[model samples]
Target: MTPLVSVYIPTRNRSALLRRAIDSVLAQTYPEIEVLICDEASTDDTAEVVADYARRHPGKFTYLRNETPQGACRARNRCIEQAIGTYVTGLDDDDLFHPQRIECLVDIYRRHSPSFACSRFKYFQDPAQIERLREHRYSETELARADKLTLPALLYANLAGNQVLTELSRMRELGGFDESMPSWQDYDMWIRLADRYGTAVCTRQLLSFVDDDRSRARIRNSSRRAEGSERFIAKHARLMNADQKRNHRNIQYVMNRQRPSLGEIARNISLGGYKSTLKVLLHKFFGVAIG
Candidate 1:
């Protein structure tokens, strides 16, 4: 029997954009798949839209709507708990998947037997740009620097992005996303997954689309950042190296909107070096991301 893959989406009040995510998942070339959605107490007509898809696809979809919002972690966990497929992945309500995404991701298991597989996403502010990148979305698949995603390197940054394809059982074992993390929840979860299992590979192909919308950006720039970053460092501190600790300590300046003193700057240079120190300083003053 062909392996089944479950694609889960957790959404809230974006009925207008939700269809693109659903359509992209349903249109996958890999036939044995299920779409599980958990709506986080949306006031909009999100239910009606889900009903329309349920009617069209019948058993192909499973929909869950919470009366009260329990945040993204809980919403995703609810969907994951009910997924019937052996292998699973996630799609943000505003993101998309190329038709060959599933086929390409599952290929990792067939070819390299990796712990997990993810593809780089094409981020766009304008939806129209997606059409231009449609050519050969799955043309290439490489070992995607699995080495960099492990240990000290991963502590420096989140190279894995937000979504990946892996076994549902493994997700359960790792215990899904942490609800307490106000931000960087995906990064935290990936670290746990990497620690539990060995390194995972990624595809260089742009098989996914991420909408860089203002709403998403607003949530990212929220005030709870200090809380989240503090928790992140506390949880992973034991595992971090001297530089990783310094790097995150410097990150705290950005999170708390505090300018580092000359002494602190000197300390950042001790492990993080000048380039990494400058990246944080630029973000603190100009609100720009270096990479």
Candidate 2:
């Protein structure tokens, strides 16, 4: 029997882009899949677009709307609460999944049986100007072999994408995504999953066309992210090693660097120096290595 996979999307006021995301899921090569769109009180025609899909596709699509604007993590949690599939994955509202993503991810999950499986993805300035890049470069041979996702690696940076496919049972056991965090909620979940079960990267590029638009830019610029980063560190500090702790403290510094404290900078450099600072930056932005 084919295991069902649920693709959940959480959105707020991005009806145009959300349409494309929904269409991408609808076009998936995989058949035994369902789509759950959690609209976070979008003030646009998000509901109408979702209704159209549900009407056309019948049982294949599910839509849940929030009464008021909650954050993306909360919206996803709500979707997870309702999903009936054995496996669950996610897509950002402004991103597109490759046609083979669902099929390939499910196959990998069956083979590895890890807590979750993720793949490499890249960004583009415009959603339409998409192109394949050799940035992540993982071979099928490599992806077939299971590798552990360690706490130190996550402390250095979050190597996994938002596009991870995880077992529904594990997600429910972990209590789903952290709703309090305004950012890095996915990263936090990945770390917790890795610590308890284990995680693997599929190496295949299964997602693409991540739009670097103003909405994402605004969230990145929010002061709430810094607070969230600090909260992540405080919550996970005890699980880290000396080097990981230094790197995490450096991450805290990077998240709130505009107020640049001389003492914090000096402390990070004194502990890790140029190499450590560079690792932190690469982990923060590019997600290079550490996987």
Name the best candidate (by TM-score). Answer: 1
- Candidate 1 RMSD to the real structure: 2.7
How well does each candidate superpose onto the true structure, as a TM-score?
Answer: 0.89, 0.84
Report the CA-based lDDT of candidate 2 relative to the real structure: 0.74
Candidate 2 Cα outliers beyond 4 Å, as residue runs:
131-148, 204-206, 215-217, 258-266, 269-276, 279-291
Q: In candidate 1, residue 34 scores what lDDT?
A: 89
Local distance difference test scores for all models = 0.78, 0.74
> In model 1, how large is the Cα lDDT of residue 106?
84
lDDT for each residue of candidate 1 in 148-260, tens digit (9 for 90 to 100): 24555667766677788888998998888898788778778877877777677777667788787765654456776667778888998888888888887776665566666
Query: Model 2, clash count?
Result: 0
RMSD of 2: 4.7
Lowest lDDT block of 10, candidate 2: 129-138
lDDT value for candidate 1? 0.78
